[model samples]
Target: MTDDADSGADASATDGSGADADGDRLDVGFVPAEVPGAGLTGAVETSALLVEHLSRRHDLTVYVASQHAADDVDLPAEDRVEYVIHDDLPKLPHPITAKHRALREETDALESHDLVHSYSSVFVPVLADLSTPTISTLNSYVAVCPKGDMRYHGKRTCSGPGPAKCVACVGVTGARRRQGLENEARSAYSSLGKLPLVRDSMARRNGVDAYHALSPHLAEDYAALDFPAERTRVIPHFYDGGFRRDPRTTAGDPVTLLYVGGLREFKGVQVLVRGLAELRSRGVDARLRVAGAGPYGDRIKRLVGELGLADAVAWHGYVDHDDLPDLYAGADAFVYPGLIDEPFGRVLLEALAAGTPVVASDVGSTDYIVGDAGERFESGDERALADAVERLVADYEERAGAIPDQLARFEPETVLAQFDELYRDVATGRLRRESRPSSASSPTPSR
Candidate 1:
């Protein structure tokens, strides 16, 4: 892939032909918030995978924002994709203004593609003005919730954004700490999202031609927030064909539970630790392997000591991406105990791919991903989580049997074919936004 922004100027100058000399390949512009790389969030990893898969059959140009003009990133050497780094914009006094200017540059660069598929929520408002057909993947809650995690006051799932409700939520909720000017500037931008003009601008669905939701539950949540239901398609993230392991036949003497994600408050890692204690109280010998790091690490570690679980919990802080497969395979079951409605749990997919049964909270699309391969407890319920883990252990073999069928739904070919069809429909202008009758009532909270 070429990293020069000007190298493809001739190719991008013409209106997308929808089919090149190959007759099947289309010019696709992939817009991700940041350059796709390892050790980043699941969303970026998903974009990287999509780019790899799509480049096999289409002409792909990835547009992203970076601090430097070029990055020394490692992608598959064989893939035919171009990286257009929009780092030429001058920095403004305010970080928010700088970000907006960068978005404009990226959006302008994407205008010549046959179809633009965006993985960035921040690009939604800017992409709305572009005439080219566009699809924005609903990977996060930034478009709907200013706090960006869809949690009301940083504790529970928010209903939907309202001018008054959001303003109060951002003002009163100690969700983010003001540590520096950058953090304060972000807080201010989130605060601005509560205002009527900005909130409405972000919420408008007139510009995006279609929405690709990772799960059915996520599509519903965005629909309630006024995203056009007809324009939304539920396409899940495919497993990257790594982490495949034979299903375990028997549970260990002491069950090993794995949790792989950021150790943030909204992640509900505290609840997982507390649940481990509850399980021990019920005479269940289980050990937790936490394989990620975040600001919540110290607090969760302190809670572990408070609960007298110093020996049972193993902290594998920030496990490398290549090393995660072994950790997933070693565990009997993986647990995701998030407090808020997760947009989609990519970690759950990784666990299932490793032939590990999942024990996740019934928030967001956990049930959709886990299917019959695991058990789910109510979100943030430690006792219930304990119960679910115990139940999975009792019937581990039966649940393990269902892994193949559940994993088949997200096989790369199946998912890539869906995207291929969506791309054709969009590029041909067959997929157009439909008008939805506006409702005055506020949206109900999503579970």
Candidate 2:
């Protein structure tokens, strides 16, 4: 891990204008350890965007704790933004409890910062024990739900986290006998560890000063997790202007249905393949193009073959982040068939910004984020997904026109203002510090 002085110096050098020298400049530290996926995860991108927007005036430092090599992720280096790669930390076992294994050494690294923002729920307890005020961003459901996606054994979405429900769900879904047992044991352990009293005790020990949710649905989840509703704010994720583009006018025949994201069961790529097959069975000319890769690649491909969609499906294999906007712009519509309760679909926002209409499953924050600009169907309902795809393809002109209104809410400036207010409130004591009450600090973990 890089020392604070080195990081501070690097940030100071980047801010050539010396804006960070101001007396009121806030020193903000960001921890993104529990970020999921491999290359350019949503949490990583959000951290980059936050630095880009917040560094103009604040002294910014990002502590990236990940299982993957630090070089794989990139961050903005302008306006006093320094990204510290904490690559020494090992990957946590279960996605949910990963947050609970926060290293004391890492926590001590943030002792000098004025305020720290942790995007990992596992570190909420550790952050609570620090002198620095802290805020946590609920980017996903792992903090509360052990399955992370809130999908019950890969079958369908569930109401919320529960030990019995999670155990039964994992027992049915887990592939191998030993794997199922492990999942059940881990699920029960994580669920019980997150009890109200346990979570409250963690929070009282300098836990989180505030909670930031990407959607109202997530804010509701936070409230259920015992976080103070008044201290929790629903701040949507911001979109980088790099995704903006002109809407495609020359729509193509065998209308291309695009799917961009991890090719996982919960991601529902198989559902998209099934939906496209249904469209073909009805004699409707349609094709599907998937631009991301995952462990489910072979399984998804096998399903496509089983459905006789070999000629209708195109695999683009993990499209680069910069190239996604163009891909969205070229497609007739972006289909997000995710079967789980997605905390927030950043890709849906990217589709809208790129002037492409979205067709997603009616789960999680899709309804809240997409609003009328996109189409939604029941989760895992292939027939309904096919219908939405056919409808959007037919009315491309009308659906594409809603892009502007849909993209307005995620405008970078507007979202940045909300974040700035929260930061200033915390920095200047306008917001209550009760969320991060003082406690006896913990010592750094030995290397």
Candidate 3:
């Protein structure tokens, strides 16, 4: 809403309200849609990493809003950060609205902060309306797409949201097919969910004084959605420190391929299984290891059995975050065949960082993230996915060697610096919404 940063004034020259005149310590509030450990969703993971990074920086006092139980997420032990849990808060269908309402109730506590940063766009209005400046990060397509996946009729990637398309894609037809009890209650629940989503969607569309896009593609998408291009900054998500593991050599034989996320249909678990079957049919020595479970877990397992992949696939449902590095390093390649427009593929970055090559679908931010470090196939193409894995199997050393350089871009400091500066800028009303990298051209993925 403010373009004061266009004057090139430094955030250091604060008015003593947020950061002190010395620009030493900054009191900030972090309001995530959901805290980590509520499931391994990307928002939760990013929040966890932010807490870890900000806590160690003594210059910042972090206040994290907890929608889940206090003990649910074992936050880092640091005096700089505190998890403010509101157990009695109503569990509204919309997380942004819920957190906003909860925080509004604690106006005194929220107002104490120098700046309030909300990862969910819907909460931006709540904070921006207050005296403190606000920064909202668009981690998903919720602000632009009603169903939030940016899928057209649940078949393929969509350009943007429209009422006619939405009627067929979301309201009536559904982006995903309902199964089991969903079949009986789909209509009723869909109606209930739509009401809150409409309200939340409207709130997200406006009042975003500052916005962070987790990927370049998402930033471009948001820009197309009428978000201020200059104010929309592209800051990719970062993993917590200690994600590095011992160097992993290529597997001698029976190469392992890993999938470490939700098992939902849009996640392309079914496509991954089909690709694995294709790999086996082609006589490639590959094993598929799936970690993390979701509502589609049973369906995925059944598909594995049906495809005669029961022996080839191991379902390690819901692996712990700490244990992920070992899995990433031990594998020869990580497979991501996501069909939906993912905002940012953190798992893909984890695979590259662990010195394991990746064979991912060329969709969403995968192109911007993996670059030439990992192999890519057309999204949802099982045959192409199978071929891509085989290519990695043949050129393992060449691809894995790029890990160090690829990993550097997302290193904590590199990514966190962008955030640190943004925090100060937003707090001091010095963030010009138009200061963004050119969107006219797509940057080539580095070698």
Candidate 4:
């Protein structure tokens, strides 16, 4: 793929010839290995906005390729939301990357869509196979590196991800090395002059029309990957139900703090645990709640026990998305201390949308997502984290004052408008070459 920022990284898309000839009746479908749920909401939510909008506004039919059984999700379905399932992929124990079922479903589908909106990087090849116009989102580094997190042996710097390095890192970390092998294979396959079917993921990423970035910080990552700066766009994630539905209520006597994501080393859950332990020892009346399961669950549990914080920390493992709203309502503050550079950090958006103030690591896309709405401290500094927590928990007025108004930031209406403008401009052949800090909203969100 091209690397020049002037052309390759800056998307210069005009409404395609197909769109000009026949776009009103185009079948705009969203193809993902799985419909956005579980722990990944950033890419899923953004794709849903496009899917939901195309279904509601344009005369388009949205088909969902679900890897699961014939069962349909209970989430609200529009007349446009259709489902297509496959029999090839098994729906048992191993379920991290739904790419296998995605390939099968796309290859065997009886129908064709006018345009394909892909959430998973693996499905880009399938779109190419079907001769469908596709825009793929680079959700993670699974497309480019061995470890899906792009984090090297618990360190932030993305290291040499070759076989020797990957295997050695996996051996030391004690995490599963087999999946890393598969990822290495996938990355190697893509690097060889880009496959026609699978190459669209990189092709569109380098210069696609109306693209989405979770935050300005994340946009920088995409820019580094050679995504056209003009094509790159920022859209903060929002909950399924628009932000206005949930009424915010204050917490009870015990100040509640929550962490809700993968419990691995990169998530920095251990840092939050250590900080909370220190808070207790320092005479703070606070409680820690964790609601996610991962390979590091046992390790986090062991660490909590070792730190003597078992009683103060409650482990409500693997809370589904449906139950998250109530969890947010019950909590006073949300914390996500990710050790790696988070692409979008949907947890921060969800917490703020629920009116639960948050404290996040000042790394990756946290600052952009926070937008001065909450507190951010250095990534691994437990004392700084503790200090931020205490500041938020100290007085009622202080917490209220500290939480910058986040309602507008996470509102779907607000983000969708920005998307509509970008898409219209792309479709109608308008180009704004300026990349960062656009005049639109100042384009600055903290760090």
Candidate 5:
């Protein structure tokens, strides 16, 4: 880390203007999937954490997709984190305009900021042009997976890198998405249906100074995307309510296996349900508490009813972020049986921070999130998932073993320090990225 004097000197060199005599100004934009103050979404959690943590040290400008007062969200007009909202965005069929708007905003912000940091891959296209340093934290598979689904054709895993099978698979959907885009100029109105979603993959590869992967293994996964390994940094997810240092150990029977994340198919909601049923048949006496709502909300409800798990499980449609603590406290074990590459499992961190033991499918950052503190199963394998959950629920040592020591590593001070390192690197052009250990599962091989 640069001392106050050296950091100030670097700032002076970058800002040429005379106003900053000491060069302490570190202008940074924390670009999120949406603005921090916006309504509840995964992006909001990350944005809030960053704003609350980074603002204590740097001048942060939070750039959002759009700032409109729908009946959904409210933003404070003034706060430590500044907001720049653009109302117009491209709809799903075409995101060209949206992409351009995002890029334009980054360019303008670069005039003031020393560097730009984003929490998602979608922001790369916008910030790539700036000579200002750039960094990103991959929250999901969107960086290498175009649909962000990690699942091809909705059922199987995607192969051969992003945009390769992505284009063909999208075309097979019969939306004629590619042709309309490729031949748009031929049409009188112009058909933009075929524009490549990964248009700036090359830029992200060459332009970004650093890309933060929350897990060590995931940093390697991006190699196929052409991102150099030297530029990839591994940092663990920063969970809320850290430093309290209470060891959360499950002491009672009827162990509750909880799953909290988007209630989508790829999240392995279906697999979880089946696994829970299998566990019950084996007499584990576990109750499942499934929270969060999404596109699969209705389908999940139907599956619960059909499987007759309505009595054994409590489905809290969508819990507010504030309610997360109580949910974590109430459960004996947290479970995530995702079928896709999850990139980094934030919920697993939240669970561990709550002192709740975790059991999740092994994919993406799942194992890294739990480390030795939790259990892992083969992705999409319901029987394997059931076995893992059963072990955690039935054994005391299994539930408490890693939960104590592993939980400490996620302390706010630790994570905030990591962010501090990234910030300093941007300000001084000296990024000494830590080769972080995998925090997801056990030291044991998952699978």
Candidate 6:
């Protein structure tokens, strides 16, 4: 990390305008969905890292909604960053509208900043008309898919969101019912996607100076929904440098395969269990370590018993973040068997950083993120998953050796440099919003 003096000197050199003289340094507003800290979800963790890195070179103010705000005891002590909490925003009737109001109110104070960066999809529309240049990070499917998981009818990956299809999917599937909302309330909230105000706001293609996609596949996904392709930037989430561990010199006796994610059905823990059964059937010696807890725990445990792999599977629900590096280093390979079009698997970065080979489904950007460092199979295919794991076990050393190269692609310094350059370009009017071509064709869905 560069000291303030060095950062200011570098900024002065880049701007070539003596803008690093304290008063002229860029002022940035960072609006993340939740209060960023360690042990939170990957998106929040990414926000925390960005706060630490960006604050070194610019003045940053983090905006947080009341409901999502938390004490900053765990946050870094960055002198150049401040936190502003907006309280008592609308909640009932229309949540998206509430988000817009809250974000707009908070960002109104940041209008004088050089640029505003939002990490929440709910606030994208509100940023559209802001006089300030804005960049939003597309972290999830909330902007297009009402259910936000990007799954059609809770089965296959959604091609893209259409008003009628999204409304029907939310009403019939009632996906938010899992959140403990009643049927009527869930329908009322989700069906808002059909309204012109809501639909048009979400489908708006321009206004923000840039959009950041965590992967190239994600950029393609959003382009299908008419997001401006010229303004979309693909940048992957970087791993925590402190999480690195030495590659395992010896494999576990039974070839331990690790999975660290929620036990939800969409997470495909059942498929991993079934794959473990398939592996046993083929006399491939392996054991599985399942971490994380969710509503699907009962079903997953029952499936393990039914498959007669009770002893071969171990459950360590909700492992702490600090212990994850050691866990990854102990395993021969880490498996991500998600069934949906995951935007990006942050776990893949964790596995690669620890020098563990990844065996993930070919869903979303899993193949792209894992690259040549891991094995991938057709999503939700138990037999194929087993085959991928078998292949990794056959050549674990070679796959593990490739991890360093893949891991370097997402190093904090490398990724932060991209953001720094982009921030400068956008702030200086060097990168302006480009008109998306009318004749552009939507890319085929990867799922």
Q: What do the candidate models score in CA lDDT, each in turn?
A: 0.76, 0.70, 0.68, 0.57, 0.65, 0.75
TM-score of 2: 0.82
Candidate order, TM-score descending:
6, 1, 3, 2, 5, 4
After aligning candidate 1 to the native by TM-score, how far in Å is the CA of 435 from where it should be?
Answer: 12
Error in Å for residue 99 of model 2: 7.9
List the candidates ranked by lDDT, beginning with the highest.
1, 6, 2, 3, 5, 4
lDDT by residue (60-131, candidate 1, tens digit) is 998766443444666532357887765544444533345555656554456778888888666676556566
Q: Give the worst 10-residue stretch by lDDT in candidate 1.
A: 438-447
**Tens-place lDDT digits, model 5, residues 6-107:** 243334434652223334547887776665656466656666666765665567787766434323555433466677765556554455446445556445
**All candidates' TM-scores?**
0.85, 0.82, 0.84, 0.73, 0.79, 0.86
| TM-score result, candidate 4 | 0.73
Worst 10 residues of 5 by lDDT: 438-447
Better of 3 and 6 by TM-score: 6
Model 4's number of clashes is: 3
Model 3 deviation from the true structure expressed as Cα RMSD, one decimal place: 9.3
lDDT of 3 by residue, 1-447 (tens): 112221112233355422245454577777766654454477777776676565444243444455567565566534546667654345556444565566666555665677677777545445545455667888877666666777776776677665566656664434345644564255435443544554545544445557898888888877776777787788987644445654455655898889999867778888989998998999987899999877678888888889988889887888887788888888888888888778898888777766777888988889778876779998878999998988877777777777777777876656766877787677677863323223233222211
Worst 10 residues of 6 by lDDT: 437-446
Which stretches of candidate 1 lie above 4 Å from their native place? 1-22, 67-70, 76-79, 87-97, 106-108, 175-203, 434-447
For every candidate structure, what is the RMSD over all alpha carbons to the true structure, in angstroms?
Answer: 7.9, 6.1, 9.3, 11.0, 10.6, 6.7
lDDT for each residue of candidate 4 in 1-447, tens digit (9 for 90 to 100): 111211211122223322223343344556543553312445555555456544443334444444444344432245656655442344332232244444444442313553455565555334333333344555665544445565666465663245556555545444432325555354344332222322344543432344555567766665666667676667665544532224334555577899988766678888999999878878887799999887667778988999988788998987766688778757888987877886777777777766677788888877767655567788988888998887666543544443445555655445545644544554343632222121233212211
lDDT tens readout by residue for model 6, 190-291: 556325443654656586788889999889988887888888888888777656776664566798999999877789998999999999999888999998
Model 1: how far residue 15 lies from native, Å: 29
Candidate 6 lands at a TM-score of 0.86
